[model samples]
Target: MAAGGSYGAALTDLGERLVGDVITPGDADYDEARKIFNTMIDRRPAAIAQCETAPDVAHAIRFARDHVLPLAVRGGGHSVAGMSLVDGGLVIDLRRMDAVTVDPGARTATVGGGAIMSGLDRATQPYGLATTGGRVSTTGVGGFVLGGGAGFLDRAFGLACDNLLSVDLVTAQGDQLHVDEKEHPELFWALHGGGGNFGVATAFTLRLHPLTTMTAMLLLWRPEAGPAVARAYRDFFESAPGQVGGGLLYLTGPPEEFVPDDMVDTLVCAVLLTYTGHEERARAITAPLLRLGHDAEMITELPYADLQCMLDDPPGYRNYWSAEYLDSFPDQAVDRFCARASDMVVPSPSQHVLFPQGAAVTEGPSDYPLPWRGAAWIVHPFGLWDDPADDARVRQWAHDTRADVRPWSRGAVYLNFIGREGRDRVIEGFGAENYHRLAGVKALYDPDNVFRLNHNIEPRIEPRPAGR
Candidate 1:
């Protein structure tokens, strides 16, 4: 659809002078360029410019603006809602710019937009250093950081944005600028948790911490013990130390080498715990969790990088994740969760995960654009399936689960997990005050709203009504 005329001519002219690949629909790699992490989403972008430099990104932006084409920025192409590709639009793929520079003395690393969690971790692990990142290794640092990343180290360090030292971004006007606490502080604040609505981030400098070995474990309990397991997990997390980070989930056993044949398709509740501390100390701290009436306890000490990738799910798997922040996990809610866990289809492997929040994540809501601060827990209903025919069933199940838990939630959702729900949901994600502020920042840097993908925040030329 976007293969000819002035748009194609402009791309061709730029490609001749650029260092990266400019692929059109007719190209052999077009299919791969358009493919994102979720196989359920099949999008065909008109053109995908794999950028190698910031100037190339700026050029792509200018070309898109000149052609009046919808633009999607792809950094690892892992958006749950598949916002990284727009049919017949220009896709600026940053995956080619995967450069990383580490400042060991300063404990900071500057990563290119295309860098994935695995790449970053590999680079930093040699120095026994790490930064806040997503749990999965394939997750792109750009999207994860911009959306307020949470991972194993979050409780010890903070959210990914909290550790961000600076970022290089290309604006709608084809201008490149460095943003941080000192320069363009407002834009920097918005970039932290404002999703990808501000500008196209070219690179990020993140603060890292020394992390050597950590104790990580997967404790599995039968479905019948869901209630007891949930209660114990809730109580343990309520008073857990800042060094401890874990989440509870109900899932069907994976067909792995370690899983018994009988348990392969059985419903089970699992607790994933990771303690970033000395081996002995971590074992002592998590001893109670290992003893929590589980059918199995698979605990071990491993490198931090290994622990980070332990939960990596394969790409192309159909998934729908919905989340809500809870003030507290009430007894009734626990009962409901247990009951729901027992009713799950044994072979489907759908899950309800509750991640505890406090300390690093419970700071003032004003500290970042992300709302839902101080919420005790984040409940995520994750649906996974491979059958195209069962798509509706999986999606509806997640939706219903989230709806059922809404009454006890903080009425806010995590941007990364939200789908194409609507602008209203986007507003609710960041709260009124924060959303308006983010909109103002968006207007100042990207007046035309060039970066409208992700959980978009509309540019505000004037002040909005209170509680908008």
Candidate 2:
């Protein structure tokens, strides 16, 4: 069952048919190519097909099926669970296909499936247009959008999947399909938040909006200010305009010009408010937080693309992330959330975050299988560190963070926000009814469940008669 030449000439024939490089174990870049964002994942795929075209993807899919090799699709390779890789299988590495084409007149952008948020943001920046993208630039557009993407502009623009206009995908049977409202409509609905259970998307055309100006304001305080800051932030953000998006987080203070020497390398509380407008308007909306006598502050008006990279978490750190959606952030919930910050491994890239969700996010289409979108608040424990000794501790912190907020929990979760919890949680993410419908779609496009490396939705198979 190994993915090497044991499949005979089929492996060699696949290499000949592909328009991209067929990288194997002995290749010079195999080790580096196999690396993903999470340092803890050390998988070795038998063959890494760096696909550059739709044909390449189709060929790779057929190759894996013919050889009976486990198939994994790699876009940004940012899956916290390392879903983009397989230990001894074939990987459809789409990193080389990253490309972005913007149509300012039409207010839309056609993004290559492998394109990252940074590429999309930069491409649209010149046209004063953008869509909801990931919090950081490195996130894969395919996985982000398909999983109901959220970001600094989500409250203003809506989830990335909300902006999806069309998707060109290759199914498990090596069939190419252009899915939208008119064609393969059932599959289109599942694509809204279904992750990658259906197929390997080659490209996505997304609706873009005018975003000529953006402002970012960061107010920092000592770790002790977490509870008060969290409460005030909760109250301020609840009524703020949709244009305002950001969160309160506790992170190890970086050695930056805006960070105080005493705060650097120590856990510090920060309230970042991003406004999709000019600095003056952002300042007006964030004045309440500014008046809290922050020990350090930074306010700037910059392009959205520039702001997207400001909080980019460095890779090569062991990561374990999980989130809890809340109906309301009451004083008790705020206290519990703040209390968990003490458990975080300080001086690392970890962040204990509280994000507000409402406005465009809540008002977005309800038909999509994004049950967590209605939640008013999201408590995210994003743990990243270097030492394996802290593995148990970091993972426990994330789990305990979720447990702390269970009282006010909305009972639904964002699948992209957490690693694999269980099948029940996955069903909860898309609701029972929606999951049932998505399972049907999975049955149509991928009945054999070829693409099961995501927040997987198993194909729903019906029982047949006793005898044919």
Candidate 3:
């Protein structure tokens, strides 16, 4: 948190030029500006520049660099590690920049860096066009896409990054550049699964797909049925088409009509099958699960945007999330996954989910940083609860789930699903070879390593020629 002697004076000057407000520790709204999605993370940044334009972002970067304060970029403000918030540093808050412009003819959407998933989804939904976005509506589009977005539609449309067309970036040195496959090819490639290591992305152009109607079938059963349901779900996904996507989760059932009174507010296993097609066809394809005889059921066809918001976790809960991608989910693994449900805090928003991966996810671009896409299954422990007392138990449950499934692990990490585990996991997220390549790109754009918050990729310095 140290800075040079003139840092305080320089910050005063930097705040004067911005169209958006610059919030410091003394400001009445400072605490509000610093709040992120994860309630557990509380950071006191030296300043928060709520950027209204890319130029504003560039200037903030310049000022932070000159003052020698660490920099953190805030998009969606949903980082579980709270990477978007830095302690006693500068934060480039992009929430004000959210604006979505869609080109139905071109099948693409250009989104502001600060926009959330709902903004992009609502804009494109009117056109009967869609894209792969995060499962939750409130998740920031910038962070989700940059971290390799995956959601209910991912199996059908591919990960959100797979649909990315271009990005507008503001480098650590305050240079603005447009990167696409044609321009800054290597830099464009790094954006695939690379965390925000190179720069602050001011905007993104993403490809869109046609999705007229989306269907979801939620079937639930008692906790004792989890092992059976898990095994059946795994078998079903083995041959299901790419349009079939969703997860088998152990959660406390909500007070829905379909949910039995006994199951409501109690832990139960649920299988959700999301199909990109219409209701009748989707139901026909997933009839096997329908016949499994669940304690409750809810099947409906809804707008893609509406489906995205259905699972929005209520905000006040403390969160601790993690994931482990698996090479295969055998019957034994199913039992282990089900057993971990006992450790989860019952009647909470916690979910012990097993996601199937394949089809479009595995068949997508192989060279991208998403090496974990090839895994057959993903075990995600998304924990949320209201009490600080349950913090230790939630953390332990996530840790134990990863440990229990270590044998089946493919040794890959999904950067978005897990919190900041360590440097080694970051390297594993992108394969070692891809990590090296990303480091080189990081060196070129961020040689000084100004953006080191998110699953950071260290810059590799290239030596000058002997003649020099």
Candidate 4:
């Protein structure tokens, strides 16, 4: 709809009933409101409804429905493909609804949909409790958990969705539903890794685990040592304990106290091992990789919340990323995986990561839509760079990284680790059978596919008779 007459009038009327502000193109903060994490995404919505409550979300949904405007939901706006923003549409901005309530007694956290990893981690940290969160603290809890969250604690605690006890959602019809194992069981199952194809999740109650102390071990080596370090890292994690989690990656060595000056701002291979215990135990477990490392090392005991912020990617960088779950990472595959790192943009936040996925991840419930949980290893090409000129180069690097390791591909992927690949890849994110079931749930909640963003799951529509 055009931005005048009924469209403008509808927004004005909707704004009056909303508890939060309504931003339009002419609004002073419209640009700021639309700004997402990825600098590559530049979209202008007709109006943005900064929703503060579930009722506010319902109102925004109804307003968009009544006006026949495309609707988008924004949490942290961390979607790499910029799925949270739509051109000439209405965005239900949920950033204001970020409230975290932690219950140490029950070992649970009821997080607002807009809450980021930092808020969730910080809230649970004081209680000596934690849950599976995203790699970085800035990630939106809704999208991350809903898309099968993987992080440093995943190996020990399981995926974020695995810890989900309940989710408060606003359906396509602007109706609120409390989903959990008892109520809306099918929808709850889909929410495990189904993305936002079902509805707008207003809040989530996640199960938290005890984590008193955490340790991070960073051991770096020159880029040439990637292949050897990759092999040793892979072998080390194969038998590593569940309490151990992290990845071996090729990245620009940051100018930290432990890093050598010559290695700073240069491509370096590093093994970041995170242990869910004190530094003494972490050092003992990571002694294998410590032996092979040459350049620099930093091992310290820190709070889980503090560790979440360690790898937070700076915003406003163009991002392109893809992941391939592997059944096995043999020596040949390791060579290919390490070789592709040379193509990555140096002196950038980009990382060619090889992460091990096992322990609790494999032992978690198998009935959910998350098929990639069975993979032994995950190769993620996380591309973050500032220069628009290197866009094509960085993109090709990610694609080539995937192509190089295709032989070991496990056929399924984690949707949160990737962008908008395609319909087939989306199905692969959730296996074909799980996708079919999720589509049925989508049919029940969002038949018209109103929330057709993220890794979308299309609702199954039964056809009418020939002569309607």
Model 2, span 1-468: residue lDDT tens:
123456535666777788888888766788888999999989988898889999999999988887778999999988999999997789999988889999999999999989999999999999999999999989999999999999999999899999999999999999999999999999999999999999999999999999998999988999898889888898898799999999999999989998889999998999999999999888888888888889998899999999999999898899999999999989999999899899999989999999999999999999999999999999999999999999999999999999999999999999999898999999999999999999999999999999998889999987898996
| Candidate 1 Cα errors over 4 Å, as ranges | 1-6, 342-349, 463-468
- Model 2 TM-score is 0.98
lDDT of 3 by residue, 288-404 (tens): 888888989889999999999888977867899999999998888888989999999988999999999899899999989988999989999999998899999999999999999
Candidate number with the higher TM-score (1 or 4): 4
Ranking by lDDT: 2, 4, 3, 1
Which stretches of model 2 miss by more than 4 angstroms? 1-5, 464-468
lDDT of 3 at 360: 88
TM-score of each: 0.95, 0.98, 0.97, 0.98
- The Cα error of candidate 2 at residue 42, in Å, is 0.6
TM-score between model 1 and native: 0.95
Candidate 4 has its poorest 10 consecutive residues by lDDT at 1-10
Deviation in Å, model 2, residue 212 alpha carbon: 1.3
Stronger candidate by lDDT (1 vs 2): 2
> What clash count goes with each model?
0, 0, 0, 0
Candidate 1 lDDT by residue in tens digits, 1-468: 234544667777867756787888877778977888888788887788888999999888998898888999999788888899998888999998888899999999999999999899989988989888888889899999998888878888888988998999998898999999899988888887888887789999999998887888788877778888888888888778888998998888887765667677888788988888776897788777777656776778888878878888776678787787888898888887667655444577467788888877876245786776567888887776778777887777667676667778887777887688888889888889889888888889888988887788889998679999
User: Tens digits of per-residue lDDT for model 4 on 1-468?
Assistant: 123444788788888889998898887777899999999999988999999999999999998888788899999899999999998889999999899999999999999999999999999999999999988999999999999899999899998889999999999999999999999999999899998888899999999999988999888999998898888888898899999999999999999988989999999999899999998888888888888847898888999999999999999899999999999999999999988889989999999999999999999999999999999999999999999999999999999999989998999999988999999999999999998889888999999889996789999876888999
